[model samples]
Target: MRIALSSYRSKPHSGGQGIYVRHLSRELAALGHDVTVFSGPPYPELDDARLVAGRATDRATGPASRQTSSAKRAGATASIEPMSIEPTSIERASVEPPNPGRLRLEKLASLDLYNDDDPFRHPDPRELRDRIDVVEYAGMLSGSFPEPRTFGMRLAREMRSRSREFDVLHDNQTLAPGLLDIARGGLPVVTTIHHPISADRRLEIEAATNPWRKYTKWRWYSFVPMQARVARASSRIITVSETSRDDIVREFGVDPERISIIPVGVDVETFTPDAGVAKNAPGIAVETSAPGVDVETFWPDGSARHRVPGRLTTITSANVPLKGLSVLIDALAFLPQDAWRELVVVGTPNRAVETQLEALGLSPRVRFVSGISDDDLAGLLASAAVHVVPSLYEGFSLPAVEAMACGTPVVATRVGALPQLVHGTDGETSAVTGSAGRVPAAHGGSAGPRAHATGEADTSADADGSDAGILVEPGDAHALAGGIVSLLESEETRTRFGRVGRRRAVTTYSWRAVAEATAAVYTEEIARC
Candidate 1:
């Protein structure tokens, strides 16, 4: 199989794009398929044995120069490497404040400053857009967000000119306007909706206060309509979790039959319990470190509970509001002092969540860990007794999953497919079925007569109370904190839940299984076409 995966920005460290491309391609390559990833800047770091493409260099000497020179050299020898195709690179104007830490050019006339942030500038957007049989372009870029639509337009243009080269086209959530044409063009198309943006949109809107703020929120989510359309047009759709699948059905009106659930898997090898087993817990220092402890374990959210001496605690890998950093901080406020703690949020810092935390008087307890690695993260997760995934919503909740994989119990919101992913230690399930509160009567109205006949009344009453960890109403900080506190204090229950979560993660969530399931879908879609 010759597969082309299209991603606008392939940040290896953050989000699901890197996870999807890296694991899926590795699995496919293992199965003897030729996978060529057609990606934008910060390309995937594929194994050298499987691929040959651009290597990152300084801005003065990037892949484009190397490729052009190599092409000329190859022309001289009349030989070219297979899959040695040059990727598209675009230069645009960067408006970001220059890094003061690094040497800067003082107003050198701003003449043709080569900024690569713009996706359309890359010739490969047009080239691969035309050439690849299947382009899995990422939808969630900074703003221009043209992965689905542009790929469709480019695919349609190429199909018209070349008379069909691909059996099917797969999209990764961009759901651009161009996809409608690709669908109308009679090509088999499938799009993966991790979950609908509607949930995030609604959360962001509710989280906003002023009119201009709400308007800005709307502008950021402007691409959602495109996704809704592409989702409707595609022949089949894939989602990461059953939670998300049901969300799509309710939110996007996509039929459940058309949607398939292929759960995302973590790299167990990279995200295992032992990866950081040797490291001493971060911020905790003893006159003599414990034997077999190598890296520091951080518990920013729950660090106040553990008086691990000398380790600098950090949390909030991405300090965005969606990540529930504010809620974690809120939970911290409920705790007494002398638990001295700090956190390091992983991604670009956002002051809004931090400022809110500060306003609540919990700022001293939290610090953001700006840049870190998966292995370092594994070390942190391994040493910590509790890892919090306070996100209001998540497509797959990678951090929580990775935390569980590392034998650390996770305290995640029972929202957005997370409950389905993480099981309770007591093997108990929450009473709440979906986010729509308690289930109503079968015909309509309250569960009166129907409840009696089916015993739903007793069931509903039983499920009402929090079970395992906690099941709070979505976005309710008080309830979320209560759940975190309950779980954090009960060492016995936490250990039980951690054991169950680890077992579930190891048995059910493996990239090998995910790859097989995904490949089955690819085969089925191609067969249909």
Candidate 2:
């Protein structure tokens, strides 16, 4: 089947959405389907060999000036070489060559409104040169994210003229009016809502102290209403977890029957444990607000516990209130100075977080690191005594799962799919079932009841009495601190949990299985069409 997959923004390092597009497209192509990913900058980083081959072909066949223009636009130098190909059989002379089974990535150029140095800030002239669409640029200038709506417009316009080119159109959460336009034109459409954008808007509103900031957040999330409309109208909806599915239903008013749940998968190969790699000092690794790991402010006061050298790492992409970084920092205050040696955060912190760290006098104990490669991350995870995810809510916590895949124990909040993923159970009867006091349920209501009837709860704990990870109440710094302290204090428990987590990651979360299940959904949707 020929499939057109769309994502407004799909930079691999940008977030989970990019990772989803890259892995899923590769797996679908492996399944003998023609997969074309329509994305925006920064484009998905595909295999260098495939990209080089494609670019070489394009350059060799096009005019020299055209080649130069393409190379300049792509921000890369292009070199071309011709290779001879021999026909396998004389019979092939009379028939057309079959299409190669490889994933194709096409990035739709747009004004990259966000700066690399400061993503939320407006871009300078150098950044503006790459942007092509005028309407998209205007949206960005107007202080609203225009990618989803604008990408949908471009995709719809492109597909309307060539609608017959694809067997199915899969949208990666860009629920824009253009999607509804395509669906109305008799094309099969599937939109994956990782979670409702409404949840994000609400979180941002709650996080805002100033009335103007809250209003600004509201304006930024104004695209959500259009998303809800498109979601309800799509032929089918896919979500990462039951927690997110329920939130979608509540926030978007979509029928429960239309949404299907498919948990995200981790690349076990890339994230596997490396015992051969030396572990960092006995400290924890903290995911910072930045994309890479920054380790500047880790040394605490003159003491032996601080000198013993262990790190506590927290990985967070955004330093927002919903991430609970402040709560984690607050939790550190409750712990004894000797409880943990140093805190290593993967991303940079926001101003609010910085203030909290300063107020608590814990700035000396925290080190922030960013821009580290995935292999380096795996090594970091393996080195850490424990991995911590302090998010108040998540559609699905990829970091927690990735940490587990690296044979590292995780301590995360019981929100979204964290419990189900960490416990290695289905959504219905996971370890943390009840909604009360668990980070104010995603949509302000109980997640209804377990869809599937089960007699007993599946224990995440192994026979050795170690759980894959512990689930704590969201926003409860005390509980979070205690969980981390407990895990840090016991090597036996930590080792057992790590073993169980690694096994769960390997067996239950393979991309091949996820792709097959996703294909089944596609088949069903196509049949309905």
Candidate 3:
């Protein structure tokens, strides 16, 4: 079927939206469906090669007439192409290029907008530049975030003009007013809300220390109400996890029946274990605000593993309190200086985080690196003693799962979907309780003894039962530290968790399976329409 996937802004490296759009669109296309993605800056870096391959296969096997019929059935007509060019007229157009002077002028006009340090921010064709500008302009005008609403307007306008171009429209969390307009115009629309934005807004507001910051955060998330309304009105709603579905239903006031739980998939190919890479010693990797790592600092001998004694790796793109970077830092401080050597951070640190590190005397021990390629990240995960995700909240922790896919043991907070994703839970029970209770008491490992000692045997069973990884209470630095320390101290336990985690990640969260499941959702929604 012809599917139009939409995202207001798809920055693949930065957020889940971009990753979702890029992977899902590719997988859908791979399934013999026609998929076209509509996105705003920074646009997604799609696997155009895959789409090209699919088109080539189609051309090789199908006759022109049959191809046309198939295209019509899939809604892949002139209306859907960026600029429909007739096959017969293509040679004439190639021979007689557009006026060179006019072309140069157009290029010059867009040079500033297109040329930037970020490769992803490059301009698309001139025809779509104006539409992209609308989203950018709205963001500037609001002084906060207005892309969703503005992009919606632009999307609605385009879709209305080409209403028959797509059989179904799949929106990636951009529930703008224009979506409502398009839906009302009789388009079969399905929306995927990774989770409620209200959760982010609440976490930010609660984390705010000053009134101005809290107010600003409130104003920034003003678009959430519109999102909630749009989601409720949408024909179908898709979310990544049961926890997310519950949060959406409760926070957005949407009917539970309207929501479908489909967990996000990890690219196992890019995140697989590198048996050749040796694990690093006593140190930690912290990703601060800055991108890219200083090789000399983290890898003195140009080795995949760090030279430090006991190394820990943690990645946090944003230094927001919700990420619990500060909590992790505090946990690090609680450990003896000699216990863990260095902290390798993948992103840059904010002023507040820097101050906290300094106060804890961890400033010297932390190494910040950013902009590492996926392969490098996988290698880092494989080489680390343990991967820690200290987020206070998450819809789904992709980093944790990615680490698991790399055969790395993870120590994550039991918040949102972390418990279910890291420490596998009984699906039937989780659906009822909305919590992956404690790991079963029968399971062996450092977790069982710790749980019993803390008088948390009943609650702890939910966590200790799983051989995948360790889960600690959210915001509990001591508990997080304990889990990390426990894993670091025992190679046998860490190896076991890593092996189990990899198996779970591959079997349960493969992109192929996720794509098939998501396609089923689309088929069901379209049939209903």
The prediction achieving the highest TM-score against the true structure is 2
Query: What local lDDT score does residue 113 receive in model 1, on the 0 to 100 scale?
Result: 12
The digit string of per-residue lDDT tens for model 1 on 1-529 reads 5444445434454556645665565555455554444444444333321221121211211122111110010011112222232332322111111221111111101111122355334333433432231232332323334344454455455445433544555556656666566667666666777889888788887888899888878776776777776676567887876567777888777877777777677666545656554444454321111223233335433333342332222244444567676666666666435432333344444656646665776554454443344555555556555566667777777667676676665655656656555532123322222221111111111122212221111112124222223334444556554555555556676666656666666766676666566666766777777
Is 2 or 3 the stronger prediction by lDDT? Answer: 2
Q: Which numbered prediction scores highest in lDDT against the true structure?
A: 2
Off by over 4 Å in 2: 48-100, 117-134, 275-309, 426-466
How well does model 2 score by local distance difference test?
0.65
The local distance difference test score of each candidate is 0.49, 0.65, 0.64
Provide C-alpha RMSD values for all models, in order: 12.7, 9.9, 10.5
Off by over 4 Å in 1: 47-148, 155-167, 183-187, 279-319, 338-344, 424-471
Model 3 worst lDDT window (10 residues): 101-110
In model 1, the Cα lDDT at residue 502 comes to 67
TM-score per prediction, in order, is 0.68, 0.78, 0.76
Question: Taking the tens digit of each residue's C-alpha lDDT, what string does model 2 give over 1-529?
Answer: 8888889876555457767876677667666777877876655543322322243422221112211010111111244322222332100101111335455666566665664656755445555542336667777667778889888887787788877888889999899998888887877898898898888789889988899999889888888998988888777888877788888989999998887777777768656766214334433344443333454422222111221235676777666677778878887887778868777677777777777777787777776666555545565566677788888789987788788888888877778888766655532222222211011223221212311122112223444443577767777777778778877777777778888788878876766667777777888888898
Ranked candidates, highest TM-score first: 2, 3, 1
